[model samples]
Target: MNLYRIAKWVVSIIFYPLFRIHVIGKANVPKSGPVIICSNHISNFDPPVVGITSPRSIYFMAKGELFENPLLGKLLTSIQAFPVKRGMRDRNALRKGLQILKAGHTLGLFPEGTRSKTGELRKPLAGAGFFALRSNAAIVPCAIIGSYKPFRRLKVVYGEPIPMETIRESKTSPQDTANIIMEEIQKLLDLHK
Candidate 1:
């Protein structure tokens, strides 16, 4: 098997039992096509949880610093993660993400630029919306509840795909589109409470 799948298998094996990961609304994910999986970032574990829960293999946009360490960088790279410079414009990262979508692949990204220490949803970066608008890809809203800790029940809920039809119907700003996506994610979180 490919290294990406291999790593996913190994991590799923370990993570499933440790966290008791539970997923809902998984049927909302499209079977195939270029799609963007937009989610809230509460912890580092959020990415893997979303990626593993979805049936499609998702290429994640991760922070560049994670690739600083040689060994760790290689491992992350092998798993289909590309680095993005945080706290800046990061045009290169944006371009790479668009390219991934244009190629008809699944790209996973957290709209919240950074993890929330308090596990509360934060303002999201506009990049996810920009990607969806630019590539005309579907955005799958997802919510991950609870902290990423061992022996705890972690839940991930996927909302229906937000198609580009909404964006095409109007001249929506990236920030506005982002807010719409975040609203969907919030609704998913509310359902679990």
Candidate 2:
């Protein structure tokens, strides 16, 4: 098996039982083609939880600092996570993300630039929307509903795909598209909470 799949198997073996993770609407994910999975940031565990539960392998856009450590960087790269400079726009990271999409691969992103201290949804960065519009990929809105407390029921809910046509037809800007994506994620939260 490839490193990413092997790592995912190991993580699933460890996390699923420890966290009592529950995945809902996983079938909503497209089996193939370019996809952007946008979810709210709650904890550091969010990325792996979402990744393992996803039906398709996802290349995540992670913070640049996480790659500073050589060992950690190599591990992350092996698992298909790329570094992105947070706060200011990083054109290189954006280009990498676009390239991933253009190659018809799945990319995972947390719209909120950082994890929420209060576990509440924050204003999302426009990167998600920009990626969606630019690549015309299917946007699968996801919600991670529960804290990372061990043995607790932590759910990863994947909502229906937000059609690119819907966003394009609305003529929304990149930021607006991001806002719409958040709204969909919020709906999943409300429905499952």
**Each model's C-alpha lDDT?**
0.86, 0.93
All candidates' TM-scores?
A: 0.95, 0.97
> Which lDDT tens digits does candidate 2 get at residues 54-173?
999999988899999999999999999999988888999999999999999999999998999998899988999899888878999999999889899999999999967967877789
Off by over 4 Å in 2: none
- What is candidate 1's lDDT per residue for 1-193, written digit by digit as tens? 9998887888899888899999898998888788899988887777788878888999998889989998989988888999999888899888988888888899998888888888778888888778877886878999988776788999989889986685857978888888889988899888995
lDDT of 1: 0.86
Q: Pairs clashing in candidate 2?
A: none
User: Candidate 1's error at 97, in angstroms?
Assistant: 0.7
* lDDT of model 2 at position 187: 94
